[model samples]
Target chain A: MPETIRDPADPRLDPYARMRERDLVGRSGRFVAEGEVTLRLLLGPRARFRAESVLLAPERWPGLAGALAACPAPPPVYLADKAVMSAVTGFPIHRGVLAVGLRGAEPEPGALVPPPPAPVLVLGLAGLTNHDNVGAAFRNAAAFGADAVLLDGPSCDPLYRKSIRVSAGAALIQPFARLGPGRDWLALAETLGLETLALSPGGAGGLDGPDLPTRALLILGTEGPGLEAGLLARARALRIAMAPGFDSLNVATAAGIALHALARAQGRLVPRGPNRGGG
Target chain B: MPETIRDPADPRLDPYARMRERDLVGRSGRFVAEGEVTLRLLLGPRARFRAESVLLAPERWPGLAGALAACPAPPPVYLADKAVMSAVTGFPIHRGVLAVGLRGAEPEPGALVPPPPAPVLVLGLAGLTNHDNVGAAFRNAAAFGADAVLLDGPSCDPLYRKSIRVSAGAALIQPFARLGPGRDWLALAETLGLETLALSPGGAGGLDGPDLPTRALLILGTEGPGLEAGLLARARALRIAMAPGFDSLNVATAAGIALHALARAQGRLVPRGPNRGGG
Candidate 1:
């Protein structure tokens, strides 16, 4: 049986307190997952993140027991009524379930680039500060089968609670690396033999029907100012052919389109099921 | 010179006060534009929407003189100090600019399907209650040169303030029609010579590569539970090939990729600029 928690101020509730995205404790490598879908993913995402504990609205406890029991070492489960749950979180905990997790170590950014014969597709995200955009990008990358994702230049933590939920828990499973000053992208791409492609609103190269190199690094940029001028110029800049008289597509949507095409060109996005239609 | 206003309770403030999306008066065909980009689009979009009046913070007037001056018969521009503006709207009005415009009359959903001669690419949206998804869908339609958009099944008003803002004001420019009770989509598609295609994850057909008919109506369903099973059964259902274990992509991102592919196949996504890349 799960422990029944009556006190909102219990020290064990620290992970749930006033947890806005900016104040999340994910920097220490621990993150929160809200909603049953996310909590379910915490148990079996085919990844290394380990759930430390869970708190659930009383109604959800029965349904989630089997998944929790399946864990090699079962995490403690705490049950609370809605009022106490809200009081503990300092906000309405509407999703009815939450899990705290510990993400395993991220490898060196350069190490994600596969050596020699194996073809690789890696997404380089730079200066993507918005948590939702970062999450959506990861979701897209996962859908398209990108081998790994690397973040640089002020990117948000993929483990940020909102990022994890928004990504449908994809952030937990996808192989990823965060590049700090210790890792330089320019030298790294060169050493990995990757043909770097940068998406731009305006560039000499069109994005639609591209013959992509076998080993490609598709780098996305900051929302408004876009990739640094030097990076845009240094990479093979590609633009999504947009209709005239309209502003650009939303960043996440643009990434979806670009990733879909690139994944198809690399044969990573081929049919997993028989009914795959050619669109 | 623009009119200077100071009172939050002024009769003219009715349109801006406590404007929750459901209570918005945009159903009467007049809509509000927030932020500079939306206000600018209201002034000069190549669409039939006409700016009726504008409200601006005093500090923004100097920068916007040219766009306002270019209006053939300038709409009255109301200027207020930041405090007065915030007070009038019951929230922080940080964008410093707003405009109210009158959208043109909507045609029957069937009218959007082309008559005998011209090719048509239309998007039929059903059961999409989220304003952001509706807005993003319209923006993608506009970017891909979709001929028109049609909404059915209790969809929210496109001209709702948040919808307009989220769409980057594309809602004002895209030709859209809402279906009334008497209209039936299956009948409408057949009458217009359009092949109806519905997007579903467990669809009979794959979405990647296809020769889309010139006159096609691509319909999207709700985020969860999807389209009514009856509706899915009636339409030619298509699925996007996703990676083995990941959750499906966000609805808007899925729409963008599907729209890009459909538009490209129909040659509706040809670039207006020099850097056109065929996806």
Candidate 2:
């Protein structure tokens, strides 16, 4: 059953208040999932995060009824009028669906990469400060069947609301862990015997040069500065060839291209039935 | 030399006023270029558009001095304080550089994709309404050395300021044509004897299937509703394989991956000198 919340000041709605501000500092250990697609992802069988509660406009109820019913451990549902919902959130809830998800314990980076011979594909993101890029990286990682994504301390949070939305809910489902501040991810990669392929414009060879190792980590840096000198030296550097004089593709776009190429080379992409639409 | 302006209401700055509003209806036959990099592109030798005027915060003048000096027929330059420039633009001009480029004429679709004999790769976009996606598409097209980009009427304007910024000025450098409202672009592709490959999740084969033809057009559609049935039927359907049950990649990311593949197969990517950075 759904509860009708008339007061914007209700304590139950605390996590949903002033979303923009909360996104910056985050909601302690909780994150928000927005829109119908993401909300469904939060409650899906493969969901890594547990939903604490769901908030939605009265109109969205009928559409989400089936999904809400399917939740094995249904979270509390709160229905509010659009006006009150907008007032509480400090912005218009255009999607009219939002859920608070709990972020459990952080996963260890070494466990994410595993020892060699496991046919693992891991995406390493370094100094990626943009939420959109982080989100897109997760989306691409999931799409290409990457076993995990390891982010350095400088990378933005993949669980941000906008990141979750931009990722098409991959942020919720993709297996990822952040290497705590000042940790050497490269040293970790070396210890695990994972082939590290760092993407840089000045890289020696093309991305299509050779068959990618079954266990490999594709590292991408920020757009303008690219990878640091020390990092590039340690990894086998690879570049995506571009037309003369052009700088580079957007960081997220580059990740997508490189991941696709890696997945194709390693035969990780799933074959689908004919005539089934991607969406 | 740059002229200094004191007032935000100056008639000479009319085109820049209320940029958000101007972006919707557009500045008649003009488009605004933001940031130093895009400004440099507008004044570059291979520029397709003509600069009507350049607006800058006084602080930006030093950085742009060389590019301005290199311009063959320098347009008038106006320098103003950041406050005055921001007021005139109805927003804070953080990049402190803006240029109004003239859209002289629209090129015919056929002219963009030449006759069959010449080796060519073209990108065709249909109903891609997002400015960021359009911009990224242009960036990928430029990076991968596509001959040109042809956008249908339903697609957003690649010349939009945000699009231009996102494209890293590729919108200005890349040769592109809008296939006017309701024009049959597929028919035009047929007339040009170009092989058409439409990307869809339900695509019959993987993207790496066979050697792509020398003259090929890779067509992409909007994210959710993908390419239309009629269009998909007319072109060879291809897809990027993904992990099971995931939706699709961001339209722009998909464009980047597809373009990179096509460019690699066609030997279009430019090889760069060792130790040269992409930026």
Give the candidate number with the greatest DockQ: 2
Model 2 score (lDDT): 0.86
Per-residue lDDT over B1-279 for candidate 2, one digit per residue giving the tens place of the 0 to 100 score: 999999999999998899999887853799999988899989999789999999999988998989999999999999999999999999888878999999999898788876769888999999999999999899999988888999998898989989999999999999999887777757777888888989888887666756777888889999889998888888888887787767468888888888877877787777553676533
Q: Chain A TM-score for model 2, please?
A: 0.95
What is the iRMS for every candidate structure?
Answer: 5.4, 2.3
**Which stretches of model 1 miss by more than 4 angstroms?**
A21-26, A208-210, A270-279, B21-29, B208-210, B271-279
DockQ of 1: 0.45
Q: For residue B183, what is the lDDT in candidate 1? A: 77
Candidate 1 local Cα displacement, residue A12, angstroms? 2.1
Q: What does candidate 1's lDDT look like per residue over B28-131, in tens digits? A: 65677899888777777365588888899999999998999987778889998878888877778887898777767777776666686677888888878989
